[model samples]
Target chain A: MAMKERLTKADEAKPWYGELPVESLYTAGIAGEKFFRSIQEKGVFLGSKCHKCNMVYVPPKIYCEQDFEKLEDYVEVADCGSLESFTCVHIGLDGKRLLEPMIVGLINLDGASTSIVHMLGETTVEELCMGMRVCAVFKPKNKREGAITDILYFKPTKQ
Target chain B: MGNRVAIVGAGMTKFVRRAQETGKELCYEAAKMALDSCDMNLDQIDAVALGTAPDTFDGVHMKGEYLSDGAGAFGKPYMRSYVGGGTGVFSVAQGWYHIASGLMDTCLVICEEKMSSYRPHPQGAFLTIFDHTTERPLKPNLLWIFALEMNRYMSTYGLRKEDIALVAVKNKNNALDHPCAQIAKAVTVKDILNSEVLAWPVQRLDVSPVSDGAVALILTNETIARRVTNKPVWIEGVGWSLETSYWTNRDLCYPRYVEEAARMAYKMAGVTCPRQQIHVAEPYDPFDYKELHHMEGLMLCGKGEAPQMTVDGITQRDGELPVCPSGGLLGVGNPIAAAGLMKVAELFWQLRGEAGKRQIARKPKRGVAQAWGDLMQVGTVVVVGI
Candidate 1:
């Protein structure tokens, strides 16, 4: 194999800098469209049930991953559920320190087989406890759109 | 040396400019169709082999894992293999080994690509494929390399652009008969010469469009294949080769790697006379000139002679040696790996006389499918027969 000549001086080697220079719009997929749209329009939670597999998925999908069965049956699940886990985040996506620590928790919605991660609100770490019930807090009707952020956060439910 | 492998089922989605389905969903549609085509359930499939374009195109990390369940590899021996464009054909070879080694009686092979996910344009992802220090400094895209290669091929044989335009004209016209074709139209050589020039010597009509689609096939050993379907297409031979990344050093006129890959597959299948023995061919045609270039490399025709054959109508559906009866990447679409496997699927459909309107006039017994990709480097070849 023949190798190209190496640069002998820094001045001789002028490097070029570039970025991807492209933006993208990804679809939420067959399951995600139904999942997000329902939240955006009605503030209701939807789950897909597979009759053959006897399983239900929160953030409902088009098919059952384990059984490979088509899942088109959508059922409404209560917005309130139990907290499975929690974490405190101190940094932002851009690698900067956040002004306030935010609580993120994984909550298992009632009547769903899986859990969804979301922001925890209206409570401090000192008051938060595992297995405690939490209810979803949706954004105002006018500000609502088809996205995960439509559900502002889950707060400790008055039990 | 090992148990023979045969393809029992095949399916594909329509190639399109954009698809609302995610990559995983694309895999599911194809996989489901393949299983249904052979009257078999997913439970009977023992293992899975998958191939697709690199993760860069979709901007998704660990894409193989994300698509695992979609390809029906859940709780099964699943493996992902990709050689850029060669990925589609190579996945079949991977599935063949699973059954041939007796490790599994049946294997499902899938190939998919969704270039539309790359946004603004899929070509942006190609910028990173270049050597960051060397080629990237020049800001060279895929078209730059292909344009350079096309010029070399044309000059080497004293061929004219009008001569190469016949391939585009023929393939697009043939694709009018294809069910899954994205943009199949009838155009004259004059139309090709008059199209907008993206790069010199490489016009808009001279290239295949960006597309999103997927294909899947079920491969089983001879014994199981006989039970699945009576018309099983055997995987006679499989071969792949990759050249150096430094495209500057290599001769641009001919694809040496493609020749080597074709020779390996031909030798394995005992094909001493490729031109005479191979009944049909489906060589990669991302660019109009690539079909002719690969035909020469595959030894289907003499170097620089593919143009004359095209002029003579020998590559048409009713001609003596029909090429790209499924419309190929040029006429149908180029979804990277999916397009490559699409050729293999075409061979299977043609061999079984199941290609509906796209069926060839002659009774072809054997066929070859080839794909080239990755920085003008790798070549993958597969030979299938009835």
Candidate 2:
């Protein structure tokens, strides 16, 4: 008999449930704090450069992964980026279809050796293309919190 | 037996309530200091062993892999050791087996913890350590467990609260000489008994503070040890024991698991008398009574007699037998895994005569460091000698 033929329907199955009762207050680390602070106060992107690895990391790190060298050289990264890849999610975490498809993009910021994954905005899935140029859409200055969400989403830039 | 293993270098960062650096950065700093201590780099290290507590403490899942590269494990054989809080000293055993098994010529052992990342207080994270089906519903935190154990130990031996409080006094005073000590204050027994009681019999002053830090050590085979440094502290023996998870059923007064683990290490180290052979001791002391509890488990004294040693000044650094000469988790700050390794690092420093002011009285021939954790279910012991 096929394995699929012996499957039980979701409604017929019983499962016990428990949630992890843990709340975290993570420190922004030395470099992460500076990066978030720069975005919150100066409205600039902060990055760290590893001279030994010849790599630049957006959302800077304290140490380089390849060489284990201390990465103290901070740089200002360009707010604009090129979309490396992206996905449009039709289903939500609760196993229900979303009212509107949410688009997420992996973007490589200028002067950065790495990319950041963030929500995409102002464009449909059909219009999204690889290597598409996008600019950061930040929230109001007064509402700025030291968090990645301070930049609401990435908007597609006009040609 | 496998090839003999020795710890050639040890290094650690200053223990703190909250650290500004990331977990990886803490690992890098300690790893670099350890490697630099022996004037060697990552090239000489064949592998890396990392030890850390629960992922909730740092808010990073798979913490071992995230913090591995910075511990000088880049493009090298890397492994993580875990035994709840016993991970720190167990990490040394991991490195020992690597070289002793003839797999790696040199291994770097690293332990790191950042409890401040947990919101409100770090103790909330330990709430999950209780059995979800049984104890979690009771909302029993660490203090409650220690209070229960302390009360049991006191009642079993008919000891006084004042006698138990002396352990805190002696350890905090010992920490005064340690540069990395966090809460090293010389408070009297009256102060401890008068301090705010979080749980009955478990005062605020009786407990170690939540902390963040990292420690690293370099271990190698006998052949490599000969060339590394003049004073290489040999790993005489290592042992660990884990009792059943049903801690409710066990007798709280005595830790049978600790005695079993200590006996195993003593057998391997060929020591019949721990009190006579072991020069110095560093037992886990997150609470004042724990130092005494673990000492009795390690067979250093009769059950309920450790407090008398503390009161008699016998455990003093200049006395007959020095215990927690590094201030232990009580005064040194407890970062879980990092605190355990801190004891082993103290043993290394003491055995090599490198511990400046905190060094014990005589030129010690041997020393033992032990760590206990996880609802009082496990005990890890490591014996080191010059």
Candidate 3:
């Protein structure tokens, strides 16, 4: 009787469920434009070297973050690098692991100051370990879209 | 600082997984309680500082301006500060500056987070917290980063899964005494290890539940504080810092930003040795391992000594250097920014000898509450005393 009396709202009426539609297109700006363009055209990695601090930033920056000086030198960085840290993930964004378990790693590119996070391919989770050398596998030139995705996952360079 | 600032009152809503009350309503409830506790009116407050995490979870843009009315911020010098998860303590820090700088005699700090409003699981909102161009394409579920960090921490420290499980057991048990705890349960290490693994190192029981809540603290200059309340918790020091957003660039084993922030606060608080000087600590513990990670960062002990401290009963409510006596985010809920403010409120209650059942066994003179967030970048620390 108490429960029935407490039911003021109709059972059929549901809480409103709506979404905030967000559509965003961001320009790479001065630094990112050059980095993505280089990946699109040359399939090479370019790091911006700060003259003041001498810190090279991969996926280069127009200005130095630390010293606030313009980064003038463009240095080439190798795609082959060592894995700093990694994890074997079983779940996707949908909350279910319908696909195979994926291994992702933070790969510090050679001659670059910062590491980039990307998927690890052509290797098993058991064999994956930090400090293992890996090289980037790029998508075919025609299919490249001037994005970080130009380099398809990274694979172990050696056992 | 021009003048000393102290916290005259504190208040918080019951942390829950979901709430019928909207964000503004939550803010109003906490703000009203804080004002009532100090026997002050809305008009008496000189300024207001608000803290809330990303707008993505609330589904409202410019949340500061939107929630201002309910937070008693109508036509006043209102400011909002955010550093991802560090927003709560950071807002309190901002409030302290308002009074200490002789700008405002009385300042109100309010933190609110309504995470339940985000549809399709609130974790879905965190998908955008990662790097949009490089990392977002990898399709990460927030758990991946936690698991990765936990794995790196364990491997570097030579720790087992059971070592960190002790934090979850202790915090949840401590939450049993909290009046507004969300998921306080007397769990064990076995229960945590047996819980379903969302990611490799992270389990269901090891993580704090998503929550909806708000907390408020009333800060005033020493003169105003003495007039407002007989017992006031003084804000001794505040420090905050952020590491590079390029999280992968640095080693995840140690939170350098947390250490830097703690060092800065300790220097200001005149705490030569945190382990001996600080009586209690509530470092951010959204994940069980994070508590241990933050203890190390706070210089409570050496790099790998936190897990052992938890194991040896040194961090118990009755133990020396009691940690997370308020049940922390693990036993309490994780509403992001609100969670941090809740820790600060616990310190206020604890220092004033007013925390009924959750009071520390050893009467504490000083305590530290800290928060860390933003892709493992930001650290906010506050030292409080009676």
In DockQ terms, which candidate is top?
A: 1
Using TM-score as the measure, which candidate wins?
1
In model 3, the Cα lDDT at residue B150 comes to: 94
Best by lDDT: 1
Considering lDDT, where higher is better, how would the candidates rank from best to worst?
A: 1, 2, 3
Tens-place lDDT per residue, model 2, B145-209, is 78988999999999988999989988888898899988868888999999998998889988988
TM-score of 3: 0.71
CA-lDDT, candidates in order? 0.90, 0.89, 0.88
lDDT of 1 by residue, B30-84 (tens): 9888888998888999999999887877667777898888899889999889888
Q: After aligning candidate 2 to the native by TM-score, how far in Å is the CA of B279 from where it should be?
A: 1.0
Clashing pairs in 1: none
The interface RMSD values of the models, given in order, are 2.0, 2.0, 17.5
Ranking by TM-score: 1, 2, 3
TM-score of chain A of each: 0.85, 0.87, 0.88
* 2 or 3, greater by TM-score: 2
Residue B36 lDDT in candidate 2? 85
What DockQ number belongs to candidate 3? 0.01
Candidate 1 off by > 4 Å = A1-18
lDDT of 3 at B309: 97
**Fnat per predicted structure, each in turn:** 0.56, 0.60, 0.00
